[model samples]
Target: MSTSAGAYTYSMASNYNRVPKSKVVGISGSEVIELVKRRLLKTQLVKMFRLLQSLFQ
Candidate 1:
C-alpha cells in the first residue's frame, strides 16, 4: 500500500514537471505587462518625489 501510494505521488509529480512554467504559475502575458507597468510607474513616482525633495532642500 505504501509503495503504491508513493508511486502515485511520483507520477503526479512527473506530470507536474511536464506542465509549462507559465501555466503552473498562472501568469499570462497581459498580467506580466500590467505588473511591469505598475513597477515602472512606482519607480517613476519615487524618482519624481526624490527630485521634489532635493529641490525643496
Candidate 2:
C-alpha cells in the first residue's frame, strides 16, 4: 500500500468516534423556518439602522 493509504488506515483505526457515511446530518423543518425568520429580521434591522444613520447625517 502507498504511504497515504497506510496513513489513512492508521488514522481510521485510531479514531473510534467517527460518524457513519450513510447517516445524514440536517436541521428539522421548524428549525429551518426559525433560522430564516431570524436572518430576515437581522437584515431588516440593519437596513433600518442604515436609513436612520443617513437621515441623521
Q: Backbone collision count in every prediction? A: 0, 0
lDDT of 2 by residue, 5-30 (tens): 23244334321243211212236865
Whole-model lDDT, model 2:
0.39
lDDT of 1 by residue, 1-57 (tens): 112223234334322233211212125765633221112345556877999999999
For candidate 1, give the lDDT. Answer: 0.39
Error of 1 at 17 (Å): 44
In model 2, the clashing pairs are none
| Candidate 2 regions with alpha-carbon error over 4 angstroms | 1-39
User: Which window of ten consecutive residues has the lowest lDDT sum in model 1?
Assistant: 17-26
Q: Candidate 2, after superposition: displacement of residue 28 in Å? A: 23
User: What TM-score goes with each of the models?
Assistant: 0.32, 0.32
lDDT by candidate, in order shown: 0.39, 0.39
